[model samples]
Target: MRSRIIFFVALIAILVGGYGIYDSVLKNKDKSSVVVNEIAPQPKKDSVEYITVWRTLNNIDRGESIANDALKREQMLLTDALDEGLRSDVELDFSPSTLFNRDLPQGALILPEYITRENDPGYIDLLVTEGMTLYPLVVSNKNLISDFIRPGERIDILTVSSPSSNLSGAIEKPIRFKGVTATLFLQNIKVLNMGGEDSEQKLKPVAGKSEDGFTTIIIEIPPTEVARLALAQRTMHLEVYRSREYEEPVYADVRNVMSNYIGIEEMRGSKNKNGREGEL
Candidate 1:
């Protein structure tokens, strides 16, 4: 009987020892898991005190390669006051100069919007960019663009669609349609070149006249809007107006253009109203 009691005690002791070992193993595993999680490096937010950024000296044109000497670094307090596109000197290596793929005005912040993968060493091509296009327009009118507006000028493009009218020759009672529609197609477009040349960046008209009587104009336009320009050129005519405004770049779509002319639509509406009054 004593041996049996001793056996029972030994069995209980073995179970207790096994439970203790299992509990210890479980605790050690949890501790190891916690340590592994804590191993991730946490950023000490307070350590970041200041940020260095670059600024522009003069007005920079699109696709113009930014020289290392033109930019001056300035330190600002590290805070959320910075914009998303703004660039910092700390992130990029300034040993190699970067190019601005877009226009950057004077006294503007140097931002990441100017940097793209294609903006690399050497001359920038206006033709190869994905969303950009080269639109060539021949302006023969000496009164319009050839003489006054030269290369490196921003101009507004006006378009008139279906300007021709039909006439049913009844001699005394000939039928005639008023006119086509006119709208502002483009505003503040970059003028690349005038008369096959950069026009020497001359503000005043050149000395002599051209024998061809036509000046070929090349402008930088987006690929998407080129189709509309093509359609307008085919169905109607385009006029160029010089712009002196130096505002930020603006973009528009074909939906913004509408027929608000007072010639046809307003006249028809007035006639319809008169007819309704006569019925009344």
Candidate 2:
């Protein structure tokens, strides 16, 4: 009986010791996991504060290379402002070590051609580093009219009555002239006429319409030909002829027309010679 009792006590003690060891190992493992989590660094926020560099002049046509210079200037300005003890609620970031080598701002400013001259509050938006300086916006007179003229469009000419001309003659009838005929020429070749009518009788006449009493004829010309036409208009009295067929003004390819005149042998000697020339 004594032996049996001693054996039972030993068994119970071994089981209890085993259970304690297991519980201690589990607690240690949980503590180790928490320590690892605390040591790991957290990720930073992806967003940064942006500032505007205002008052830049319009029509600043510095090419793409200007981006680098603009960035350097922005950084220097920001650093100077910070040194002056200027404080704001915003958190400023203009670190050179960051992306872009601290050269430029995260945003850009697009300047206009002309600004209002009458002390009008004109401003441009620029992506600038913290503490950047802004200069007054400047503009050119040519840029003011850039939007008015464009590629493949009629010229926007602003004409005013001559002071020497009789005011009564100019204003009397308001010259209700409509459907005036005009001749259109491209490279001195008359391509089409303005009015739909074919005969001269149907074409109405306007008195004092032009200096010689002939109606002024306006023609749509390409940008390259604008200077040529301007000179021509000043020297020549433009006349309008009516046509039976109301044909749309068509532009011809001068190159193709010239090419047709070249003989087969001459075309073959040229750089773009194709074997199929004059084959048809």
Q: Could you say which candidate leads in TM-score?
A: 1
RMSD of 1: 22.4
* Residue 26 displacement (Å), model 1: 99
Instruction: Please give, for residues 1-280, the per-residue lDDT of candidate 1 as tens digits.
Output: 9999999999999999999999999999999999988867878776666677777888877655456677777786656325544334444434222446677778766765565433354324632345677788755353254436655567887654433432111113212334444556788787755543322432234322443355556788888888887766655455677865535544332234545433444455343544652111
Mark the 10 consecutive residues where model 1 has the least summed lDDT: 166-175
lDDT of 1: 0.57
Model 2: residues >4 Å from true position, as ranges? 1-4, 27-72, 76-80, 85-280
Given candidate 2, what's the lDDT at residue 96?
18
Once model 1 is optimally superposed onto the true structure by TM-score, how far is the C-alpha of residue 237 displaced, in angstroms?
Answer: 1.8
Clashing pairs in 1: none
